[model samples]
Every structure is written in C-alpha cells, then in structure tokens.
Target chain A: MTDRPALSRVRVVLVQASHPGNIGAAARAMKTMGLSSLWLVQPKSFPDAEASARASGATDVLEAAQVVSTLTEALQGVTLAAALTSRRRELSLPAQWSREAAQTLASRAEHGEEVALVFGNETYGLSNEDLRVCQLPVMIPANPAYSSLNLGAAVQVMSYEISMALATPAALPVYGEPLATVDEVEALMAHIERATTATGFFNPANPKRLMPRLRRMFGRIALERDEVNILRGMLNFFERPLPGSAASTIAAPTRDDGKA
Target chain B: MTDRPALSRVRVVLVQASHPGNIGAAARAMKTMGLSSLWLVQPKSFPDAEASARASGATDVLEAAQVVSTLTEALQGVTLAAALTSRRRELSLPAQWSREAAQTLASRAEHGEEVALVFGNETYGLSNEDLRVCQLPVMIPANPAYSSLNLGAAVQVMSYEISMALATPAALPVYGEPLATVDEVEALMAHIERATTATGFFNPANPKRLMPRLRRMFGRIALERDEVNILRGMLNFFERPLPGSAASTIAAPTRDDGKA
Candidate 1:
C-alpha cells in the first residue's frame, strides 16, 4: 500500500483485554486498515495459539505488538488519545461518534502528531479511572437494542473509519502550543495530588470523587505543554508557605521522595 | 426494540459458505446491526458447536435462518439482491461502492420492498452464475493491498453500512411496475435461454459467455415486473415457429422439464 503517514502515527491500545484471540483479531483488524502500532496493557496472554489463529496472516502485527503494564505506559508519547466507551459515564468529555472521533484523530495524525485509540476489556470495559486520563471519549454508533459488538469487530470499524477519514482528512485548527504528552499530563496530575494533600484541601484518607473530577476537567482541556508548566508552577506556590508567617511555623508533611 | 421496517426487510444471504464459525460470527454481526433475516445457501455445516460458540448471544438469528440449496432459492421473493463481490468480474454489473449500495438498498426497503445482500464462499467469492442473478454488486472499500476481509468481517462492514443508511435514508425516485422479483427475473432468463436456442442465436452446448453476458445486461437494467413480462412475451413469440415457414419443420431440443 502507499505510505499513509497518518495511519502509521496512530496506535491502537488494547487495555487489559482478557481474550487472547480478540487481541490477535484486533491485530489483524489494525493491519488490514494499514495501522501497525499495537499496544497491549496487561493482556492475559501474548503468544497464544488462539490469538495467532484468529490473527490469520496478521501475526506480524501481533509479534511486534508492544506489551505494557499500564494504560499510562501504553500512551507514553501519545499527544491525543480517545477512550472507546460505549456507556455514558458520570464525568467524561462528551463522547464523539466514531466517524467524528476518527476525523479528529486522523487530522492530528496528518500533522505528524502521535495519537492513540484506546479500547477496554471485552467484559468490563474501561474503568472510570482508565477513562479519566484520556483526552477524549469516543463511541461507535451501533444499534441501541444490541450494541455489543465483538472486540475485533469494533476495532475493525474504528480502524476502517480512521483510514477513510485519513483519505480526506479535515484540517484541524493548529494550536499555538503543542499538546502535552501523556507523561506530562500524568506528572501534572501527580503534582496536583501532592499539592492538594499537602494543603489539606483534599484528604487522601477520604479521597472520593475529587481526583476523578480533576482528571476529567484536565482531560477536557487537552492541556498544552506550556499550560501544564504554568499549572505546575502555580501548584508549587500553593504548596510553599511564606517565610516568617504563621503557616511557615507549621512543618509540612515529609515524603520518602523528599518533596514536601 | 421499536420497529425498523427497513432493517426487517433486509436479509443476509451467505452462499455455499464453508466455515460454520464464520456463519455464526455473521449472525452476531447481523443481530448487532438489528438485522435478523439470514439465508444460508448450501452451507458446509450448520447447527455446529463452533458456529454457536462464535455467535455468542446471536444464536437466535442462527436458529431462525432459512437454509436452501442454491442462491436462487435463497433469493426468492427478494426484489433487490446485491451480490457482494470484492473482485471485479468480466460480465458482472458495475459494482457500487458499499455505502452507495447501502443507501440504494435502504431506500427500497423503506418502500416495503424486500431485499437481500448476498455473500459467496470465502475461498471462491461469488460464482459468475451467482453474480448474474443478483440485481446489484457491492464492494467494501478496504486497504487495496490487504482488502481480504474475513467473511464475518465483510458481513459486519456491509451490515453496518446498511444499518447506517437506514437511519438516514435518501429520497429515491419511485418507479412504476415495481422491480421484478428474483424468481420473476430467473423465469425471464430461462425463457430467454430457450428463445435464443430455438432461434439458433445462442448455442447452450457452447454456452461460453452468452448466458452470463445476458444476465449482466438484464441485471444492470433493474428490470420491472412489467418489463420482464413484456420481454418474456416477446421471447415466447420469437420461440414460436413462423406460420407456414420452413423453420416450423425443425425440431427444438427436448428437456426433462418439458419447457419446449
């Protein structure tokens, strides 16, 4: 096939998929649509026969698929990632229909921006925690009566749509600053967690929906690298106390990593 | 689920399919798209364990499928049958890209015309004979280098397209006399065969490409019932010996069915 730079930049992340055959079939689906990058987050089995048999001629994709332990690791350098969620969640970014989401992902990928399409397990689907870090929510418009498409079929449809969108990619508005990488977003979330705990605004012991809400808010922002830096700086100031002030008299909690 | 008259009118026909598992997967695909009618033409095996296992929750569709011995039998009562052919053939009608065909099928179904989407065996897609009878040809646009979609995947994509089209049907021009049913077209072809043989215009003993060429020609016309009647009437008149002409003394070939 001709070089599809956009397809090459898009990674398919299967998170905690239990069925090895499904993983293999998904590999085949990806390859058939000209996508090669495959990231498996905590798959139950990697080189099973069932998966290879299902993959048919696409064993190459399975053989080269990257196995990671976490969705975060799977999304390492991805600038834009969409969580494939069929159900409505309490606080996810408004889900874009598969075609629209494919267009968005394809547009970003056309500009050489690394993007990911994340799929959850066959049974449980993506946990709220898993949906939290992804910048977008994507849903396939299937029959409401029986919308449960097999994992492989879902991958096939999404990949096919993305390939179609790439053929006539819609121009996306370029941001002044590059979007924050997955790692940058993770780091900012970690910093916010620390700052919130230190300031006693959020109690770690009673951490209920606070972190999830914050994650959803940040995910919706599609934070740029500069925005991440500015946010982290503000968080640092909030965590630090003024010298000779009453707040300074009280010692801050110490952590094993040395940052208070 | 609420009634989707268009979906109800559509039937998925698998012809001489070899894989029982693919049969089951195709059932699941149909059900997910709200399509229930399934017609199997000379399947290698049915009611098999592998097929049921692959069907998951869609065993209902498999259990209700109508099994027949030939594509013609499967397409009975179908006003519009599209032969899903990925490969180009010499005498087949121009294949419509899948989405466009779906809109065509959906529009007819919305008007209460029964339609069928026919797929052939995995190894040797639709035979020339099978392609000749269907009114339309449909092709799913996949990566050209690896357009070999698995039987189940192909069904899934086609079903998906039809379902999507049904949701937003395009206004189609209504025609008089309604389209000829598959059986009506088959009868017309049989009459033409006899008429051509009687007039010494076509030698079935050296059939080569005559029948297929005629089938493609008639298929492209989307013959109306009245048109089929008129054509068959003309053939009947031509087949009859000219009054007091020397041709009356010549004997027409006898057949077991005794049409002559």
Candidate 2:
C-alpha cells in the first residue's frame, strides 16, 4: 500500500526456514519497512495457522509470498544478492557490515535492478555452496561474546537498515517556534551586553573578550524565536531601575558600539 | 562479557508487556547488542517456561532482569530517558528518528550517565502519563500504510541502533592482494601505451586525449597488484608478433613519451 519504488524491487528470501513463526515474523518485519516481496526456499511448512497468527496485520505479505524449491530458483532475476552470515567462511568474500550491504543493495534497486537479501536457517547458517551462489556476504555487528541474534530479529534489523538507506534524508523536527531571525539575534546580543554592563558584571571600559565569547556561545545554541523573546524579557526585568535608587536616572549608555 | 562500556549503562524498560515470548525475545535482542540491564514493570507473566524457551541462549539476561512495580521505580537512576512511540501524540514532544535518538543516548551513556530506552505494551503503547514521564519521544520511521512494528522487533531495531552508535568506526575488510604501487601502475601505463601504439590503435602523430582518458579511467579502478599483473600479461600476449608476416618484423616504437 506504500509507495516505496526501490523497496518494491528488493526481495527478502528465506532459505530452508524450519519454524513457521519465524517466517511469519519476517513477513511482518518486511511489511513494516514497506517491502512486499517475499521468497521462501524449501520451508518445512507453509499455509500453517501458526504463521498466520504470528504475522499479525501483515498476513497479506505472507499470503503473496513465492515458495520455491531451491535458492537458485528463488534468485531468478536478482542482480545483487547478499547472503546474511554471522561469520567469515573459507571461500566466502569478506563479510560486509549490514549497513554498508544495505546501502549497496539500495543503490542497485534504485537504479531498477532486482536485489535479494537472503537469510539461511535458524540453527545452521548458509552452506558453502549457498554462500558461493550469492554475490556478497553480509554480517550484523553484535557482541562478540554472545552473537546469537534470533532469526526474526535479524530480519527486522536488516529490513530496517534497508528502509533507512533507501529513504530520503528527513529534516529534523522543530518542537516550538522557528529559528530566530538574524536581526532578532543581533538585538538579543545588544540587550545582553547592555544588561551585563548595568549589572557591573561586564565593564565596557575593560571589556576583555566577553562579548565575543558570548556571541560564540549563543551561536552554538541556535535559539528559537520564542527562546529569544524569553531571554529579552528576563533582561528587561533586570534592567528596570528601582523607584528610590540613587540617580537610577543615571542612564546606562544605550549603545557602546566601539567597546562592543 | 562484552567490552562495550557505554552499552552497559543502557537499560531496556518494558512497561506492561503482555506476551512472555516477546519479553524473552527482547532480552535476547538486548544481550546480542551488549546491553545487560533489563527492567520489566508489571508484566502479565514472568519466569514462565515459554519465556525461558524463547530466550534461547540469552537466559542469563532474563535471569538478571529486575522486575519493578512501577515505571518510576524502573527509572530511578536514569538521567536521559527516551519513550519509544510509533506516532506523535497530543502533549508529546516532536518525535526524533531512532538513529538520532540513539546517538544522543549513546553520547550521554559514554559520559557515564544512566540512560533508559522505554517501550510500551503490545496492544497499547505508552500511555499519556508514561510518555510525559520520559524526556524525549523516539520513532522508527516506517511504511505509512503499515507501520505496526511488533513489540519484539521494535526492541531489536532500537538495540541495534544503540550498539551501532556506541561502536567505534570499523575499517573495511581487505581482500586477497595489496593495492598496486604507484610505480607498478606507472609501468603498466607505459606498457599499455607501447602495446596500443604497436597495434596501430593510437598513432603518435595525431594522439588526441586517448592516453589521458585511459589514465583517468584506470585511476578510478584502484586495481590490486594481482589485477595489474593480469592486465600486463594480456597486453604482452596481444603485442607478440604473428609467426611470419611481411613487415611484422618492424617493431613498435619503445616509447612515445612526448605524444603520450
């Protein structure tokens, strides 16, 4: 139902899957990531109730899956196939981290080439012949001490990475007001300088790089417009002179362009 | 057992998880990613045989998991907490993409701050009160049409992202042979020019941009030493004269340095 053109060309192929639940879970994983293609190679069971129940809302993916007898048949038109393995084997190519493998596959799929991400059985991974059939070996980096990832979890992680690789970079969310305008920032800087001078925290006569340091610090904060208004309001409250203060009338200079 | 110090400080808190199997799967996911701390708040069932069976080799994590009565108790010492939510809610902050949220949490954990990644129930996600309790809302980008990620699968994706964020940059694997040396490449270019001219493919009198184009193309290939040797061997075969042609005796010029 989603419009993921590249993902549509990327298929998830599970080889000799034993547990039907895992097959169902993998279908759900692929569906969540906008991938619909599924290929099964000699699964022990199919059209089982366990799989349907486990697939939850993604039974559409399971119902439409292609079940084939062998891995070769499953990879009919795949231009790029990545074998998901946990370790490096004798004649296998150097294992790529899943993220990099996903990127490579995504680029190929984006260019209208069919690609497959193949996973082996839960107990024993791909055989030597199966590894040789694929173009690349991909590994998910895990704790070396305990590197056993559940079959369904592995599928979820790989699917998630592929979705991320194919997605357009999204703009970071802005929680509140838009960023302060340049003029607003400059005005805030001026107001800060005036308040600091009146409070005797910063002496304009001996201003020792304080304004420059403040400017650098504020530049990093990237304040929102609302944040700027709040700061200016605080400054105004601090600047108002007390009613009976000694020559509160002695106005702090509004601008000290040269010193600032 | 892992050397992941930052990951050790991350706690996975599951609130009111309904299924025991999902609990076990979450534990396995956390252990695979090097995160050891797990907190369960009011789970429907725990220490069940089904949960233990599903945990597979990660029973150690489940055994060590702390069961708390409330979310506040689960979040006792946490400094930064991210609520894993699938959608934006009424009073919640703008949701962060899971990758950025992982980076933020990882940095804080690296600085020795206790951080928690909180997940809600399978049927109903974090309540409004639970979401408000956490500092940030995190979302995993998914298909708009079918964004229902299973509870265990969400844990797997989040744990993978956190592990990736905490991991040091890894060097790409190197295959069989070393890269061709600069001298070796230059010599191969020289040999190529000699062979091409001898074959009458390039005439020194009107050599226009061919050698430069070849050099530019070769620069991109980054051939290994073995590949360079193969190319040179093929050139040598092509350059050998046929048995007894008329002026096949006329040898090709050794070098066309000026024209090349």
Candidate 3:
C-alpha cells in the first residue's frame, strides 16, 4: 500500500458526465483505487438518488466531490493534469501511455505536487479544447476495432495504474549514484575537445561532427559522477604525458586517426 | 485500429446480473473495448427496457448476447479464463494484475486460444466455485478503504486493458540491433584477457577478479556486434607493438592496478 498522504494529492476529474449514476460509480471506482479527491465538471445531476445508490457504500467520495462548471475551473492548482482518451487527435497535446502517465503522476505527487487525471463524457471523449487545457494527454491503448471505454471504467483504469505505481518501486533505481552535473559534463566535453585537438586526433579547423556525436553518446549513457571521472581520466592520459612516459618522445601526429 | 479477428476470439462472461441496466452497460463497455462475445450466466432480467435505454447505441451487443444457465457452458471452448474480483481468498488460484492478465489473454488469443474474462454479480463477487472454474484470478488494486468497483466499471477496465495490450507494441523495441551472441561475447572476453596479459597490465597467475568484473561490465552494456568489434579493436592497440613501441618492451607486472 502507498502512503495515504501521497494518494491524497491525486485528483480524479470527470468532465461533462451525462448520467448521475456514472458519477456515483466513478466515485466508487476512485475510492477503490485510494483516490479521494473527486472533481466533477458540468455534471448533469448531483445529489441524485441514482448516484448514491450506484456508489454502493462509497457515498463519502460523492459527498466530497467538487462540482464545477468548467474543466479549467476543476484543474485549478494542479501541477500536472493528464487527459485520458482513446481517440487520436491531429494537433494533440504531449501524449503518454497510461502506465507512463501514472508513473509520472505518482512521482510528482510523491514530491508534493498536485496531479489530476481527467476523463471525458460517455458519448464523446475530451474535445481538443479540454486536451489543450491539460498538457499531458494519456491514451489507454485499447482494441483498435472498438476503442471506446466507458467514463467510469476509464476512471478505474487510471486509478488502478496510479495505485499500482505507488505500490511498486521504480523499475530502475539509480541507487543514490548522483548523475554528473550539467556543468561537469560540459567541462568534460570541452576538456576532451582540447586534448583531442592538441593530439591532432581532432582537427578543430575542420571539426565536422565529432564533438556533437560525443556529446550525444555521453547524454545517452546518462553518465554518473564516477563515470564522468573515469572518462575524464582517460582523456587526461591523451592530454599530457606522465613522468617517465615512453610515448612522450614521439612527435604529435599531424593526421587524424579517423576514430570517434 | 486492431485486427478484429483476434478480438472475436475473446469472450466476456457476466454471472447472475441483477440489474438489467448494468448488463446493457457492460455490453456497451465490451463493445467499446472491441469485445463482441458476451455470455450472461442466468441474468435476472434481459431484454428489459432499462437495459436497452442504457445501452446507448450498443444494442447490437445486447442483440447478440448469449444467455446461458451455467458457468461451464459459458466457458465452453475457452482455453484461458480470468476471473475478476477484489476479494482475497485463502486457497485462491494464481492471481495477476489486470494489465498482466490482459497481456496473458492477448498473447493466448493471438495463438488462437479462446479467452474468457468473467465478472460476478454486483453485491456478491465470484464464489470459490467460479474462481476454481477460471484458470487465473485478476484483481484490480483499488483503494483499501473503498474497494467496490461496480459491475460495468469492472468490465470496462478489463476490456480496456485487453484492447490496449493488443493495440500497443512491446514497450522496448530492439530496433533491428542484434545483440552480440554469447559465443561472440565470450570471444571478445578471451581476446581482451589475452591482450591485457600481453601488455604486462594483467597478471594471469595472480588475477584478482579484473577479468570477471570486465565481463560483467560488458554484459551490463548489452554490447551490439559493432560495439564489441570496436572495443576489441581498442584492445588490439594494447596487444601488439606499433613501429615505435616503447611500452611493449616492459616485462609483465606482478602487481594489480586496482582498476576494472
């Protein structure tokens, strides 16, 4: 189980739900996933008997649900709001899979940021306008043939993902090995360029793409402090000859080695 | 859109539904998730006006719905059946999360196996008998405080997961980069050890785990053929003496360098 405090930071927002029963059922779904904050945008009805009956002992969630007039009004103070949809849009917001979006939401919530998972109406999903308000558009990969998830079910799926993400630790743990700071990486790159230039291994006058490739390689590695130190030490070997070094007698090469 | 033929192999079974509207809503949920085959195990009411009204244009699913008397009849030729419930059992079958269960179902259906996702009544979930009949029990991790997921919502979550598993490609794509084969990796390790031995850098007799550490490091990198070849080429520079070789004349060292 995840800490309740962290779960409390997550809000489940339903936009324009036509049925009052679905609103109640969505509250039930949210309660099951440990999400307490419920925001209802332009709901057709509230305090309806049908919603309370469908909630099935989750009336507490419905009682605490915030009824709002607009999606933007419901999203106030949220650091990240993910719009859940199965439909594809032409000019879409930045998209992520449900799992990825859940992880992002969980991580942000852990750091004390408010997060919201937004759902659309039963008949139609989020309009482009709703998606525009929410920066992150999350798509639950569904069967391409039908690809329609009910509003409450969408809530359950997102809630389940968020709960699971909070329950499980990160897939890859860095183990406290701090990554090399941007300044440290920049210094290493500059040091490499200088050393390679001095050795005639890199021609500064005709430096086409070697530096950029090396930069990309380092970025891909996501170099830790120790890795940066080791790489810099290797470059140092080429920059200056050690005491009693035999290679020092040889003149610096005037030709490139054709190596990256 | 996903190919429909694969989806047609999946069956959705709902047992003893009391409300006609939930049955209709479940059918709609299944249709949205691209599941067509629905078997109702003795529903209290079918073809009810409320159900038709709740279906909201998914009447086709209701039109084709199969009303069966027994769970065994509903499971018929299905090879894999996943029972959905939130309850914990003392002697339960193997349990999986909805996503994991969905992946399993998708893969099995891809191989032409008939798959069934079973849901129980709203008040009481699946009995032990129902679970025993099913091969895998799937649980939606909902909040511990309020874990009641409505019948329609449960169907929607499972259907959405199955559809998404089918529509999305595997999370990590190799991108046609064939990793170095075991034999190739072994050959590289052997070549590195030999070169390091010849360079008076590695003491073969008193080797203190340097070779093993290097082997593990390379394994962690998951080196491709090109990367392996490049690394071996770098080692070659240390193995054989160049025209003006001075370091090559040095005798093999007795001490270890404390470097991996």
Candidate 3 per-residue lDDT over residues A1-260, each given as its tens digit:
64567789899998989888888878888888888899999988887998998888889999999998888778776756788877555434336788888998887677666779999887887876676556567887665456666677778878888888888856533324544544466667788777666545567899865665454334333345666675565455434442234443442342234432
lDDT tens digits, residues B198-221, model 3?
Answer: 544457899876677566446655
* Order of quality (DockQ): 3, 2, 1
True contacts kept of 2: 0.42
Write one digit per residue (lDDT tens) for candidate 2, span A137-180.
89999888888888888999999999998886333333343545
Q: Where does model 1 exceed 4 Å of error?
A: A168-260, B244-260
Model 1 TM-score is 0.78
Give per-model TM-scores. 0.78, 0.70, 0.63
Against the correct fold, how does model 2 do in TM-score? 0.70
Q: Pick the DockQ winner.
A: 3
- Tens-place lDDT digits, model 1, residues B1-260: 34787898999999988999899989998998999999999999987998999899899999999999989999888999998987666646667877788899998898889999999998899987788889888877666667667788888888888888887668875865477899999998798677555544557788766677556545655667766665565445444443233333232333333783
- Candidate 1 C-alpha error for residue B107, in Å: 1.1
Interface RMSD of 1: 38.4
DockQ of each: 0.07, 0.15, 0.20
Model 3 lDDT at residue B185: 93
